[model samples]
Target: MGYQELLQNKQYLFWTLQFVGWSGWAMSFYLGIVMWGRPPDNYGFYLPTIAMIGMTITLGLRWMYHLTWDNGLLTRVVAILGGSYGAAVLWMFSRGVIFYNAFPEERKVYEGGSMSFFSYFDGSVSAFWVMLSWSALYFGIKYYLLMQEERQRSLKAMNMAHEAQLKMLRYQLNPHFLFNTLNAISTLVLDGNNSLANVMVTRLSRFLRYSLDNDPMLRVTVAEEIEALQLYLDIEKVRFDERLRLHFDVDSAASEALMPSLLLQPLVENSIKYAIANAIDGGSIAISASVTGRDLELVVADDGPGLDLRNGRLPKGGGVGLANTRERLKALYGNKQSFRLSTTEPHGLTITIRIPLENTTDSE
Candidate 1:
């Protein structure tokens, strides 16, 4: 069992350890007396009485140490040393009193009192070492538990911050797309194209509702995400008409695989903004998904002028959509996912993403 699990039932843990530790010490003490070949006539009763006294004294020491737990280091150190020495003296005196009464023949040497000063001093020295060892173990366990609690708290705080960052990045969809869609609808209405404007408005409503209904923290099926993307593309198709061409190449095996909701929207939007809208004849965008080994691979490519590379890197005006997408992937998958940009064949841009394949059954 884990230390935390054992510590949860502290009363049981303490009593169990206390019984085991003292019993083992008593057994060893008895064995040593036997090995010496001359145990006391009433060694059974005498030894048990001495062990009981030691256990009682150590219990009191435990209580005192607990009271000084939050004190300064010097104060705690002093308490341990002083408390252990005092307990040892009390234990040794109790042992002497029991031994004196049990052996009347040996009492002639100290007929005036129960025990002599020199006897007390010698016994207390040995008892002091045992008491000190117990005290050290108690404090060592206390400090270990304290450190564990602090580490758990630190990890919890980091996870909360990580979640907040991910939510911010997920919700940062392109505002320019919203404004442009509204402008297109306005233009369509003014030109006596009320039917097409109404269609665009319906598609825009569905897309916004989809974005609002799903939580950023949750993943969606590949099929469900594609359905939401279709709503978004419907609005764009109205504005571009024949200028926008779209294709899908999703494997049936990958359709039920799960991915972060709205993950592909930003990539596709970046393609339309940078490649299609800027080109005279517009462009064709192809989105494909397939399962490769243990990963789900997704690709978004467009047939239009690709980004001008400086030192093999995107220029400064690389769209916020790409950056936002990159940040979201890092937050969700850490280093387990990959996002890459490359030049498509015959002059275009291609963005590829690979993430661990998780299916609906895997989630359950």
Candidate 2:
């Protein structure tokens, strides 16, 4: 692998640090001896030999420490200290043998004085310090990298959750409307009204085409949304006949304002359910839109029984459409958008939505 790849790999990094640390330490030791007028007889070979020995022992301690590093702070500390001391003793014995063979005359102190373990350990004090430092740095870096990885994973999971919610809201429209329209067409065919049944089928196909063409996460112009809603109302008109009427008063200037695709379908469908279908004489549903300063406001109101407003707001058991629309609006716009439901003047329900006027594109 390349040098950059080697530096990134944990196993390679450990060996690199061992080689760099010991080689630098040996170079400094040799320079110190030279400056003090006590230069080694053959430091070119001797210093390199010492560095290789230190690197080998350092690598062994690294593996030993890895086996018990996560046992706990107390356990790791004890293992590091004890393991470092043991490796230092072994290194000292190897160095002693090399030194005596290279210069037998320099072994006067060992021959003349009493041999003891303390003397060997005293000579290897520097090795213990090197091993301890290596252990501290290893654990510190590993923990920091682990924390970074966890934070990235959390952000990825949150993004996935947001996308899933949008998809659920988009697909919710398909089955509910499909079932109702198919049932209406079935009734028309059974009554020998084949021409009207064919008209309903055609309108239903056009409505589903518009709804399914775009991605759930995409935003479309207000004019585009209105067109899709018109197609839906046409299909319902077949079922309700002269009993259902729709009025559109969209401001030309605000028609191009962007909104989530199919955002208004459920609200209009809710009006049909609780207003037109529930009334004996049927009812009229009106959609109006206008832009005022920094905000775009749209309203869907119908003349029917209106809400009960028992405790406050509409009665419970409201269909999934209204609830799903509310959740999607909250997820997309947070607190920047508003959805308000209230009873109309005489007897009816009105849903008002206000969103920021962020789209600058004119209707095409």
Candidate 3:
């Protein structure tokens, strides 16, 4: 999505492959010349061939690293170091042919260094040094690559966990609402309220369609949310008759606001189940929505018995009340939104949910 992300992604792979190929080429070419005792003509021809051989092996190591290994710094280091060590050993043995046919002049090649380096650095000795040097470099590159991959994997896993927690929170609210709405429909049917029951059944079908069709990357408009809420409330209407009244005072601009899917239906279901369904004379639910700056604030309030107030007491609708709502808000908005609850007026509980809409793209 950003420059840094691209660098850490496909570009990183490209650069790593280039680094490995060129490094091994340089290593093999120089080693080939040293092994040949600086042969005048064949030296150039054999060095390029050796470079190609070295690169072929390095590319294989890279492929294995990308596809099979854990893609962690440690695994990359082990694979490259181990693989290149084997390659170097093979190269050394091939060049060790020069060691058996030794002469005074051949050893002189390693003697020119300022440290008064001996012929011990020539022929087989020189081959060993080149092989081991490339091996060490292989290990270092692999280690760094694996570390980068491990970090990226950790971040992806964390995001997955966060998204799962959000889905669970949203799901938890569903069964409670299901049980309550079904109970209301049952009561209406038993009392022979056919017209109301049919209406509620239609609303229930539409409500379910929205609930079950949620996608992870899309936000639902505010209008869609309120429509689903009204559908759920329609079922409550049949059960409560005149006693359950709902008032929606939503700003015209707020109706187009974007939010995580399935947000409003849960809050509205909680209001009906805990407030209107549990109230002695039933109750009224008032929904007020407004767009404040780039954020949307929605308040679902009701006049009913105050919070259970008793410590450790679960609310009437199987504790799916504010807890699930809070979790869903957290999952969808992370720490960027708020779901505030308080009691107001003579017989009411009010919940104020605020969510930013400027970057509503990530909500689902």
lDDT measured at residue 250 in model 2 versus the true structure, 0 to 100 = 93
Q: Write the per-residue lDDT of candidate 1 for residues 1-364, one digit (tens) a residue.
A: 6766887666777777778877888889999978988876888888777887888888898899889888998988899999999999988888888887887766665666675634656878989998898788777876777787788789899888987887778676747678888999999999999999999999999998999898887999999989989999999999898899999999999999999999899889889887889888999999999999999999999988888765544567798888888888888999999888889898888888999999999999
Q: What is the TM-score of each candidate against the true structure?
A: 0.80, 0.64, 0.66
lDDT of each: 0.86, 0.80, 0.68
**All predictions: root-mean-square deviation over Cα?**
4.0, 6.7, 7.2
Kindly provide the TM-score of model 2 when superposed on the true structure, using C-alpha atoms: 0.64
C-alpha-based local distance difference test score of model 3: 0.68
lDDT for 100 in candidate 1 is: 74
Identify the runs in model 1 with alpha carbons over 4 angstroms from their true place.
1-4, 7-63, 93-121, 174-177, 189-198, 310-313
Please give the ranking of all candidate structures by TM-score, highest first, separated by commas.
Answer: 1, 3, 2
Q: Which predicted model would earn the best lDDT?
A: 1
Candidates arranged by lDDT, highest first: 1, 2, 3
Per-residue alpha-carbon lDDT of model 3 for 70-100, expressed as tens digits? Answer: 5777776666556656665555554433432
> Which model scores highest in TM-score?
1
Residue 159 in model 2: lDDT: 76
